[model samples]
Target: MNNTDHTTATVEPAIRLESVTKQYVGAETVTALADVDLPVYGGEFLAIVGPSGSGKSTMLNLLGLLDGPTEGVVRLGGRDVTDLSETELTDARREYIGFVFQDFHLLPTLTAVENVTLPTAFTDGQYADRAVDLLGRVGLGDRLDHTPDELSGGQKQRVAIARALINRPEILLADEPTGNLDRETGVTILEEVRRICERGVAVVAVTHDELVTEYADRTVRLVDGRLGEGDDGFAT
Candidate 1:
């Protein structure tokens, strides 16, 4: 092949949405997303920003495989998963995706180390050592014995982040992850997330905070269920 052809060879995206749409069929039909096309590449951070009810949550669900599209396809590693059985989807989700929510979601009764190792319950307990390492990586080594109620907001969020990493997923989907924290605390949380992206995991965060745009490799705006232009070139 010529040099130009070699250089231009396309790499499959970690996750992709093709002409996707999501709608609710309650009393009256409501469209949450419409014809959304997006690509999340490994080792990059993509931010989804929008006003309230603009479908940011819907988009996150689709990306995380928690929900299927009403139309079009959702692909993981370039393979269409829009028609997978529930059991297959569950397996794929456990193997390929991790999620961090706005609420720390740590069990108030469990110690930080226990919360981080919870995912291992689904498989063998061999991930115990890795859980400890991840907690240290998130700056929670000294607070492993503390429960959610005992830790500060930033620390709790850090624990949540460490918990998300236990499965060693290829994609991390964060929904308003910094929403509950103060600006300074949120910045720290975002820093930890940036480190995760640096480790070659595809990170997609849905947020209303414009500050997150600064940390993203690309930012795409959502408006009334439609995707707007995306800004690129912020990668370190």
Candidate 2:
């Protein structure tokens, strides 16, 4: 390898919110998030914690590209994607990001491997072997043929974790990832997620569950639409 290769390459955040804000202009104006600047790097696990109605969901939506910021920009791999069209945004989402929802939204009719490959539906490739491998990564190799109802809550979540990794996303957005499970199961799931982070995927999780902080490399909190790094917006 050329020595210049290491010297010339630049590292950028996997996804970031640069001076972002979101407001709901209804009968009343509601500022969901205000001027927040956050950068999540690969191989890092970041936990965003706050009470309900404190803009956690709003942040997740922005990070996941499900919605855009009313101000500032959302950047992916250092590229500004703040103003992408719906089609472009959809493609961006599919190519760059993965999500783990608390509900484990697996299709009841699909087996674990089938559900793991769902995100690749519009692509022209089949990923059966990769899906099987991801299931094995999450300790669900034996459950590949099981449907959502056939698996326990934790097993379903393990499947969800595997599904999120199938696309090899640079960033993984987990919304309340452990909210639906008991303590022991939740710990197992968190371990799987941390392992994913260690493999160089950026993991951003929004949660009210304090247990997430134990696995996170860093923690931040949102309060009244503002972001900070302390107990309630000071630590960042």
Candidate 3:
């Protein structure tokens, strides 16, 4: 590679894994990730594809700060956060990372706006206005008062996207974001996510569906706890 290109490539990423490995110790020990190095940049959407038991969830957990690697470094905004205290980690998670789940995870009783504002309870700032603004951005402005049960699957996922952005997170970690939706709805949700990535949030989604990769700027596959280049248009 040219030196200038290499230099530009060194720009700090939103989140990175440096030789990360994860293990679970039970009656038998299982290794889930092995020496994986990945750097996901701002304004980029990355798709992680894998089969069952392939450690895709483990990688997502480490990136979301819900769990730490058994070995190696996880950098957020170019800083090593592997050794932060639980309280510090919580603070970092609140300030820097956002998450979306397959099941839409919205509290049943909260209205759309209320659900979007849920993350505000953990931090100091007020975000009621911001939450409404986000709902609008996700095209949910008219549905602000609706509860999860009152919304369609696509609308519910839209609300979840709004909720993930309420805190103005730097990176969004989505696990099977479109897993529950029908094909048409899933594509719509993927488009929404792509738009968000275009606006400069790093997005990392672990998905089983090959269609999801169509919206990703790049894709990588995980197999038996190892990482390698994935499809431009992905395959199982």
Candidate 4:
């Protein structure tokens, strides 16, 4: 069995945000995220639930190292990376993090397999072989040659999910991953995410879908850029 197939209790958190806050400065300085503390562990599916303008995107950006916090520390594999340079942060993102966005960002011109292998372009095709395996794992074995335009909504999302795992990242950050799918399709995609979490990849999903929260190992609500109440029990 692969190392990612089982969750190990001894593993440290994949990412941790301690008293993290994000502020945008312009005509008026605005705080996007307040002092938020979140720790994401391997094999965990954590849903960050909130309405629009409630800081979900801000938190996802901070967790994915796409943006630095105004204050506090962001740690990846327990190492403080809050002050890393842009180049260092870029390298860290490529090595340690995977991302899936709301829109199936598959290249319209690329085949499913090609889209899955896109991440390899940055690493000299080191993980190119895994593309086929990932596509099969996501139940798209027969759609390998299909382009995004030829696939169903769920199938296209499956391609995106497989692409996210091509790097074998320690953490997967999904922002409104199911926003474009129907209810049934969304459920199918969320189930795939649950399976990935079971395989020991920490999954942090920013979403407004209550149904998505039901699949999470734990759910934390955000309101007015701060952590709110409504602690759903962790997955057993």
Task: Give the Cα lDDT of each candidate.
Answer: 0.88, 0.89, 0.89, 0.88
The digit string of per-residue lDDT tens for model 4 on 88-158 reads 99889988899999997999999999999897775666565688889988889888899999999889989
Give a tens-digit lDDT track for model 3, residues 80-170.
Answer: 9999999999999988899999999999999998899998876544687888888888888899999999999999999999989887788
Query: Candidates 3 and 4: which is better by TM-score?
Result: 3
What digit string (tens of lDDT, one per residue) describes model 2 on residues 144-187? 99999999999999999888888889889999999999999999
- Clash count, candidate 3: 0
Better of 3 and 4 by lDDT: 3
Report the Cα lDDT for candidate 3.
Answer: 0.89
Error of 3 at 165 (Å): 0.5
Residue 226 error for model 4, in Å? 0.5
For candidate 3, what is the TM-score? 0.93
Give one digit per residue, the lDDT tens place, for model 1 in 1-236. Answer: 01123566877789999999999999999999999999998889999987889899999999999999999999998889999999999889988898999987889899998999887776777777788899999988888899899999899989989988888898999998888899999999989889999988999999877778889889988888999865531212
Model 4 ranges with Cα > 4 A deviation: 1-11, 124-126, 232-236
